[model samples]
Every structure is written in structure tokens, then in C-alpha cells.
Target: MSNTPSPTPLAPRRTVVAIAAILALGALAAVLILRSGTPGGSGAEAAHGHGHSEAAGHADGEHHGAAASAHAHDEAHADGEHHEGGGAPAARKSEAGHDEDEGLIAMDAQRMETAGIRLAEAGPATVRSVLQLPGEIRFNEDRTAHVVPRVAGVAESVAANLGQNVKKGQLLAVLSSAAVSEQRSELLAAQKRLSLARTTYAREKQLWEEKVSAEQDYLQARQALGEAEIAVSNAQQKLAATGASAGGAGGLNRFELRAPFDGVVVEKHLAVGEAVQDTTQVFTISDLRSVWAEMRVAAPDLPAVRVGEKATVRATAFDSSATGEVAYVGALIGQDTRTAPARITLPNPDGVWRPGLFVNVELTASSRQAALAVATSAIQRMEGQQAVVFVPVQGGFRARPVRVGRSDAKATEVLEGLQPGQPYVAEGSFVLKAELGKASAEHTH
Candidate 1:
């Protein structure tokens, strides 16, 4: 080995420089490969130039070719920003081309051929405006009554049971009262006094006729008899008022509680031999011939619901529906719910409209002419604020934003954005909505 430390292992710096140079060359190659794959490459430029030339020569052919080419270029350059304004030009061009091809004019033609879409002439349709309300069934206030004992005493017997039908004046219970016995005694005394006065008056009348007595004496006896007769009549009325039989006969203290109205007993608060007060309600009777449906209407919808308007009440418990008129609309709105109360009166001859039952109330508002009405399924909610509908086009479906009007569970009135005799997707609208959602998610990602 020669001196000078064997050339110091040839200095490793040279090896390092060679490896870095090779890496730089590989990176440059990769950059060229990526640039050629984009729309800004020479091939794409040449295609654009050819398109311009064709556009100047044959306008129709150029239009179609330009649209197709632009669409392709947009897809190819989606990740690249080498084109004008970093991809805005391609995006705008692609969108414009798509709009021209699948616009409203184009969709109308495809609607005529699509079998899945149904087209109805948008003429005047009779739309019966309806006001939906939350309601509950209640008893008819006019025909219901509570049977209570007039005199305070223990309930000796109870003839009416819960849910039992009773006729007017039917005995519900019997009560014994000391107060009733005292009134009977007064009536007996008044009757005795009246009898004695009548006997004395008869003798006095005989004396006057024979001219054996003065006219003033006979008149006094007759007046006394009249006073006694008035006293007896007063006592008889008092006894009757206490639910007792008059004329000194026993059973005056035994009071009979009778039904005031013919109805079914809905509530019974007292049992046989139960202690009762004067104000204690024994039996609650409700006539089922007529019932009321009480409903709550929102404050905003109150204007449409008017008294005497026709309403239909449906109960889940029964298959039949009742037709009635709006009987009342409350003047005040509920503080918590901000809703107003409305009542519908319906005949319940079969006792179908039971109280405390929940029912659906539909108030029919004034009917109006609707120029165009589509099934509610035809409208798709987009972005919460906008509504979209798919219209069949020549190549594909076109999405349209529409302004909607009154809508019920079944149909929706088209206020703007659609025309007469137009065909729109109705049944498969959910498919279009899913597509929109997918597109939006893809854009976000």
C-alpha cells in the first residue's frame, strides 16, 4: 500500500452525491408522467383546437361534440388545476353543457315516452281544503245530568250501577232524612186546622141563610176558612219539594233519588247505606244520543276553522265515521300549546262516540280550484329549504327545484316551477333523492 493513509477510503462524499442525483432524475420523470395524464397535456390541447375548428365550420356538430368533450375533460381534470383559473373554467363549461342537454325543454320530450311517469293535464282540480285537528270525544253537555239527593241522609239503597242505562224518573237511590219527617208533621197540622175551619164555615153559612146571624160574622168565618186553606196548600208544596208524599201519610222522610234524564250511568260515587251529604252526586248520567268531539286547532289555523263548518270525526275504536258541524270555537288560545279549542257535535244514536276517547277530526274548509296538483311523493325535500323533483329527459333525469303550495298527506299543490301536462317522477322520487344525497356526500368528501 502506498503512503497517505490508502487514499482515505476514496472519500464517501462522492457516493452520496451520485445517489442524490439519481433520486432527482426519478422525481422529474414522475412529474412528467403525471402532467401528461392531465387535460392540460398536448393531446388535450390539440383536441381543444380541433373542437374550435369544428365549431366554426358546423355549428350543430360542434355543439354536441363540445358538450361531450367538455364533460370528459371535466372528469379527467377533476384533480388537476393546470387548466384556466385552476379548474373553474372546466367546471363551469361542464355544468353549462349538461344544463343545455337536460333542461326543461328536453325533459318534456322524454316525459312523453317514459312509461314509469304518469302525466295528468294540469286543469282545474277541486281541492277540498281541510283543517286537521287533534280532538277527543266528550259527552253532550246538554243531555247529561247528575242525580243527587235533595235531602241530606244516608243512602239506604242504590239501584243504578256504572254503565247501566236508566230512564227519566227512574229511582237511583233512597235516603232517610229527619228534616223530611219534620216537614210532614207541619203538613199534617195544617190539614187538621183546615178541616176545623171548613166545618165552622159551613155552620156559619147556614145561620146567615136563615137570617139568624149577622153578615159580618158569617164573612169572618168564611175568611178564616180561606186562610186555613191557603196554609194547607203551602205545606203541601213544601212536603213535595223535600221529595216526600204529602197528606200526613208515612214515608215522607224516605227520599227517592230519581234520574232527571234518560241516559246511561257513567259514574256512581255512592254505595248502598253510604253516608251522603246534600251536595253529594250519586250517579252521573250521560245521554249517548248526541256526542261532542273536542279538538285543538293551532292559533294560525284558527281562522280557517269556523263554527257550522262540516267536520268528520273518526275514532280508532270504531270503523265508522261521524259527520257533524263545528259547534264552537274557543275565543282564547291555550297558553302552553298555543292552540284554540274547537267542538264538533255528532249524533251518536248507537253510543259509538264515547266520552274520553281519542278521535281524529277533519274540518272541511272552503273548496278551491287548483290548477296543478301532484302526489306528495313527487316532491323531494332538498337541503331543508329547497324542494326538488325529477323530470324524465331524453338521456337521463333532470332535477328541478319547485315552489310548493298547500299539501295534504296524499297530494301537493304546485304553486310555481311546473307547467300543465308535464310529466314528473312520482313513485320513484326516493331513488332520485338518494342520488342527490350521494352526490352531495361525494362533493363533501
Candidate 2:
């Protein structure tokens, strides 16, 4: 080997190799520092290393290959996670946006007016606790009459038909009866006898006064006249008691059945030429200007029902309604239904309340003062959940769930979820609910 002063070619080659290895290490360190400083710098760094590894020694190449493989694995995992988990965040963001847009009904004053959407404020009110009972319209028993002939008779003519309106004392039917004829005939005979007795008595009294007849003869004549008068009076009463005229154009046997009062004939069992007994109900007449709304009150509700309590009767078959008082209440309960019968007398001047019409009898069991109440029409049902009221907000109305208590025909008691003086939809609440449904459906799509 040459001295230190001589030229050293091998040494220079060794120096070159060392320098290359040093440069490779430096580059690798630089890549690691860049990757650490900027997490997204790995992709460019990996590409640069891939090309440089070809020129570097095998040892450097192997190291670069390991680093690049590790980098690729990390990149692949990150990319996969980004692709899979990225959808979750985006989906979550979209759902959040939809959630914020739900249950919002936008309406203006003009739209509300056109839709008949009226608004009212929730405030203190008297809520009547109403007890609804099923009932039926019936003939008022006090105004109904069952007509019967006083004597067995053959009906000569039925002047009145079913459902005929008649005045008091109007002839309903004419009947022929042998029993009635006998009474009238007896009266005629007694009257003839009385006429003769009266003349004889007058002569006797005059003769007695003139002393032209014996006193005993006069007394006997007077007694005979008195007895005849009694007999005639008895005959007249017998004919009158049977509701028969002593004499008629038709015949003495003709008996007239007349209406007791002004009424409508609801039922007729007698017809021309029909034989009827004394107790037969020939007709049923009723004054239909008033009717009875009868209901069966459960034993538990009996205490609340009284003879004079005001009641609202609503027809079930139609939209007819009337107000009445509880005219009567049964003292006894029905064994089968465990209820007592109650009656409400209603004025039906129009005759619209026909018998056998089903109805609902609403009675105010009690009245309570509520801190918050609203019109019953304000309540709306959403998805079969608890009732909700549309409360006015800054822009529109918001559905507010509420717990309800007592309710009446016009107002409802709001137990919760409402503030006094808060405006709410007192009418046309159903329109808001429909609009909300449409909005929700569109968001889903």
C-alpha cells in the first residue's frame, strides 16, 4: 500500500460508498420527518422512495421496500376506512337535516283565513264534566192516552185513521152496542112514567089544598111521583156513564169514542165492523208537541242524575239536538243492566223527535275551573298518540302534546303542555295535521 501522501483509489471508492449510504439514510430520515409533519405526505414520499430504491444498494432497496409496503398497507386501510365510514357521517348529516325540518307547518294569515283556520288563546275556563249516556226518544207518558170503549160494541165506523191529527172531543170512532141501547131505552120509559106521575101529583096536591081528596091519597100520589123522578134520573146517568148519547141520528145504540185532547193518533186497533170488548185499546193518541228522551243511568252515575238537572239530548241518527231537564229518575235499578231509567222531557214543537230514535244524553256531572283550557275543536290526534294542539310560534304553529282532563261540548280542559294565554288553533286543526303529514312524506322520499 502507498504511504498517506500517495494517491489512494480504493479509499476513494470506499469513501464514495459511505457517502451513498449516508445519503440514503438521510433521504429515509427526511421522508419519515415529512410524513410525521404532514400526515397526507406519505403518498408522494412513497412514490419518490419507490424510484430511488432501484438506484440504491440491495440493503437500502430492501429497507425502502419494507417501508413502502408498510406505507401502502397504512394508506389502503385509511382509504378503506374513509370510504366506508365516510358514508356514515354523510348519512348522519342528512338525517340530522331532515329531523330539524319535521313537524313544521308554515301558514300565513291569509292562508289561514281562506282555510277557515281560526286561532284562539288558551285560557282559564269552566270545563263541564259531561256524562254521556245512550238513550232513546219516546212518547211522553204524561201526554199519551190509550182510548177504549166503555162498553162492548161493534164498530159502526172508524172516522179516525192512524197518524191522524185530531182536536179535543173530535169523533174517533162510532160503535153500536146493545148495552148502551138498553140504558137509553130505560131512560125513555122512565121519563114517560114520570110525566104521568107529575100530572097526578099536581092534581093530588091541588085537591088536598081544596080538601077535595083524602090526605093519605095525596101523600101516596106525591111519593109515587118522587120515586118516578129518581128512576128517570138514574137512567140518564147510566147512559151518560157509558159515553153514549141518549139519542142519535144513527140509533140509540150508537156510542161515540172521542179524543180526550188535541193529539195525533199513533195507533189504531179498531176498524169498521170490528167487535171490541169494553177493555180493548181502540186507539193510542199522544200530544207530540213534547217528547221524552229516556236513558239508562248506571248505578254509579245515579247520584249525578237528578229529577231537574239540565241535559243535552243529541240524536244519534241525525244532527238534531235539544236541551231538556231530567224530568224523572227511577228509584230502583234494573237487575240485568245494573242501571236506573231516567227521563228528559223535551219540547218537540216541530215533531222531529219521533219515538224510537236513538240519542245521546249529555249531562253535566260537575263543573271545574281549569287554569288552561281550549276549544275542543283545537285538539288533534297525531299518529294515534296523545292529543296535540297547534300552538302559534314565531313563524307558524307547532304541535304540542297535551294531557287532557275534563271536556264538554264546547271546551276541553288542558292538564299539561299548554300555557295560559298561548294562542292555539281553535278551529281547522285537522288542516294543519294533513299538511304535516304531507311534509313528512315528502322528506322520507
lDDT top scorer? 2
Which residue pairs of candidate 1 clash? none
Give one digit per residue, the lDDT tens place, for model 1 in 392-415: 667657778888787765677888
Report clash pairs, candidate 2: none
Find the 10 residues in a row with the least total lDDT in model 2. Answer: 54-63
TM-score of each: 0.59, 0.79
TM-score, model 2 to reference? 0.79
Give the per-residue lDDT of model 2 (tens digit) for 1-445: 8567866555555444444544554455454554456664665566566635543443432444544545665566567557766687899998997776668788889998988998899999998888999999999999999999989999989999999999999999999899988898899999999999999999999999999999998999999999999999999898878778777567878899999999999999988999999999999999999999999999889988998999999998889899999999999998898989999999999999999999999998888998889999998888877699998876777899999888887899998998888889999999999998898788779
Candidate 2 global CA lDDT score: 0.85
Model 1 stretches astray by more than 4 angstroms: 1-122, 247-250, 296-299, 316-320, 331-341, 365-367, 374-404, 408-411, 415-445
